[model samples]
Target: MLNDTVSPDFFRKDAAFDELYPEHIRELSQMHWTPIDIARKASDFLAVPNARVLDIGSGVGKFCITAGFYHPETAFYGIEQRGELFSFAEIAKEEVNLSNVAFIHGNLTELRFDDYDHFYFYNPFYENIEPDSRIDYTIRTSFGLYDHYSRLIYQMLDEKPSDTRLVTFHGPDKQVPPSYRLVNNSSYSRVLKMWIKE
Candidate 1:
């Protein structure tokens, strides 16, 4: 049962939370998944009650799961293009029993930005440009793909209304549109940054 499998402490740390995944997926936690603390902090900034937050290329649903658990009043949704990663995220979400969180098996291009009030990104397209950092060979990667996705996301963020909130981890400022202003950033969390559209 989920009740038997889950505990308060499970969400407290990265190691304990990552235990929800299988060994192979767990191994990718450090490099790919969002850390628990960073997830919580990002959620705090993005999760306005009754609002929907979208995690772009949410690998294995780490950010969605952790953020949803921390901020139940807000809805957390993740979009992942990889079938294998999406499947694992679904399994983990079921195990966690978090009703406010959801996972979608599709590319970020399939998303409608109007559907969400806030956004979170962990430099999902970086893998395409950084060959050594790629998660797997399941998807094609290239500098072209990275640039395309980055421009697409920049346009998406630009189109959002004023007051839209966004959080990014390990992403460059260039990916963020100039209309969005940097509001808060955590040094301890490294590249964790919060932005607001003006």
Candidate 2:
């Protein structure tokens, strides 16, 4: 069971929240993880009572954990391909004691989209094309893999039910299906966009 009243202390700033993880994981914050404010805004858009929001390519579980903290009624699930990141995500979630958050150690292609009602994406595939931006060498990175993953996500989103919500932070619009209408975008930056399936 989740606490009825949640504190906003951990979410006060990016630096504060990064303290939940180790030093190395904290160093990857700027490039790899979602900021606290963006996570809150994205969660507000995606959170529906009892809905399950999937964070595609969840790195270190930053987005999922933050979203889960703010929206106790909704569940936030993260699917990470890296085992180290997945393990760290689990540890952070335990420290936060958030029951609404869960992390899966697997690739996005292995998941069944039907299990989730909404999505949060943060340009998880960019590392494939940009060699310097890669998080690590644990996974294979190639332009071919990038196209394959992007196309797979596009197709998956196209098949979701009507009214399904999606939030993309720093993600390209091309990855989203044409059927998903642009609902709105964050005032903070054009990179954060919200969409809904028609």
Candidate 3:
């Protein structure tokens, strides 16, 4: 059984946090889940007080849970298309006891962009283009879906009001609209970028 009283330092390492999920889910961490440190840094940039941050494809709720744990004032929401992943996210959220985090099981295109104030994306569409990166077989993957989702996100980000924050980890820069200016990023890599709409 897992510990009920999660420590304050639980955020220190990925293994400590990954304990929330089962072995199979934990195995996917190296590729799928956001590294604990990256999630912390990205959340720091995006979690303006009372902001609603949406993780475009919140796989098993790792990022959302981490962000919500660190930024208690900000609410984090993740939309996942896979029911299996969504179920795990909900279970993990309960174990963590974070009221500020939520999980939605639905397609990204079905959501209203206006519902969220900020965005976090981890190349959710990559699996569509890269055959080996898919999380599961529930969602159809194709170059066409990649193009469609990319175009849809580009246009959506383009329409957001000024100062809308966005953080993308290992994401395609082209998916971001020219209106969203890259402001800050890690010194080691451009893989993680922080952006704001002008």
Candidate 4:
């Protein structure tokens, strides 16, 4: 069980955790990083003992680390396409001293969806076509790449067995396969959606 006191306030108070990155990266948290509250809630829902959970397009490992710490019984893995972000995630994981969280530097396409039982996604592909919300110019973002990734994820999720759990944050419902049915939603409405396969 996770300690309720290990909340956002607790993490934020730790200077090391809050200062994991430089000024620019820190500034991006409000827009890109998953909030601690959301991470805890999602982890609680998807964390089956010894189950594997994947964070699609995990930017800097914020979600993975927070969730892993709260739910130690479940292993959390993150796949990031950007090398720089992947590096930062590794360093932060070391600082936090967590062992269940791991990050891979590669595109989401390379991941084997069968390896994971549950998933957490934070609109990992939005930057591909949304010009205003682009994370950086380091990555190649185009409508074609966005469509490809979406289709890949949709198909992979479609193949998963029934009762597979998934949580999407600030993502379009269309990206999810129709086989998955909505289980519940946060009071925040569209921002956080929980689903389970039929």
Candidate 5:
């Protein structure tokens, strides 16, 4: 059980935070989930007071839960295509007791871009192109689906108003539109990048 205060100690390390989930879910942490530190850095750039941040292909809510826990004033929403992952995300959010985090069980294409003020993506569409990196066999993945999803997200981001924020972790740079300028990036690695629409 977690402590009542939910101190920062609980999030000090990825292994410590992975304890919130079951054993199998914990196993996927190294691959499918975002590290706590990366989540924090991404949230720092995306979180604006009262802003709604959406995590595309949020796999077990790791990004959303971490962001919501750190930034209570911001609402973090995650849309996951897998039902099982969505259930686990909801459970994790409940366990963490974060009111600002929400997990939606649906595809990214179904979401309305206008509903969110910012976005975070961790190469969600890569699984469609790389079979070895697939989270599971439950969802159909193909090169065609990857192209379609990538195109859709590009269009969505392109349609958003100026000043919309975006963070991409290990995602393809081509997916981001020219209108959104790269504002900053993690010095540790180029895998994490922050962008703002001009």
Candidate 6:
């Protein structure tokens, strides 16, 4: 069913479309990649017409591409630390020919938090402290880095203007600033949390 053009509807239904990555990467999909349904829900909440949304640790551009498809008016940007993964994200984005989505290969520390209107975080720093959960040994993983990134994110979110939107998936709630109160919580609780700064 797949041809030159990548259809958003096909992507949502076909398992192969979601499994375009290698077996190893595909294996990580369930644990790491955001599901199509979840991405749709998150995108709807984050997309404020022309607002820009940033995925703090966009693994393979799944969240960005899916979000971009549903909300063409909103721009989605992803910051990925791993070079290989970043490359894959670029390739996938090209295949879809979506102008609203872009991927940057760099650490989250290099980005300016103020540039984005909203955020989607999927425990971007979790692999830093947990050796077993690491996607790969390619990047240096340390508790110090985890602590630093967590504190840095907390500070960034704290400084954002009121009404800034954020959606955290599989997060421990430590990285979120106290100033941002939980506006809505899914029955799934920890996995899906919607927050807005006070």
Query: Considering every candidate listed, which one attains the maximal lDDT?
Result: 2
True lDDT of residue 95, candidate 4: 72
Model 1 gets an lDDT of 0.88
Q: lDDT of candidate 4?
A: 0.86
Alpha carbon lDDT at 11, candidate 2? 84
> 154-184, model 3: which lDDT tens digit per residue?
9999999999999999997888999999998
Alpha-carbon RMSD to native, per candidate = 2.8, 1.7, 3.2, 2.5, 2.6, 3.1
**Model 5 alpha-carbon miss at residue 115, Å:** 0.7
Across 1-198, the per-residue lDDT of candidate 5 in tens digits comes to 222345665588999888988998899999889999999999989989899999999889999988888888899999999999999999888888888899899988888778999999999999888999988889899999999999999999999999999999998899999999998858745899999999
Error of 3 at 12 (Å): 1.9
- The lowest-lDDT stretch of 10 consecutive residues in candidate 4 is 5-14
- Using all chains and alpha carbons, the TM-scores for the candidates as numbered come to 0.94, 0.96, 0.94, 0.92, 0.95, 0.92
Model 5 ranges off by over 4 Å: 1-5
**Which ten residues in a row are the worst by lDDT in model 2?**
1-10
Badly placed stretches (over 4 Å) of model 4 are 3-16
| lDDT ranking from best candidate downward | 2, 3, 5, 1, 4, 6
lDDT of every predicted structure (CA atoms): 0.88, 0.91, 0.90, 0.86, 0.89, 0.85
Point out the worst 10-residue segment of candidate 3 by lDDT.
Answer: 1-10
Candidate with the larger lDDT of 1 and 6:
1
lDDT of 4 by residue, 12-96 (tens): 5333454877777777787888887788778878898999999999888989988888887899999999898899999888877
lDDT of 2 by residue, 1-198 (tens): 334455667888999999989999999999999999999999989999999999999989999988898899999999999999999999989888888999999999899899999999999999999999999888899999999999999998999999999998888888988999998867965899999999
C-alpha lDDT of residue 164 in model 4: 95
Residue pair clashes in candidate 6: none
RMSD of 6: 3.1
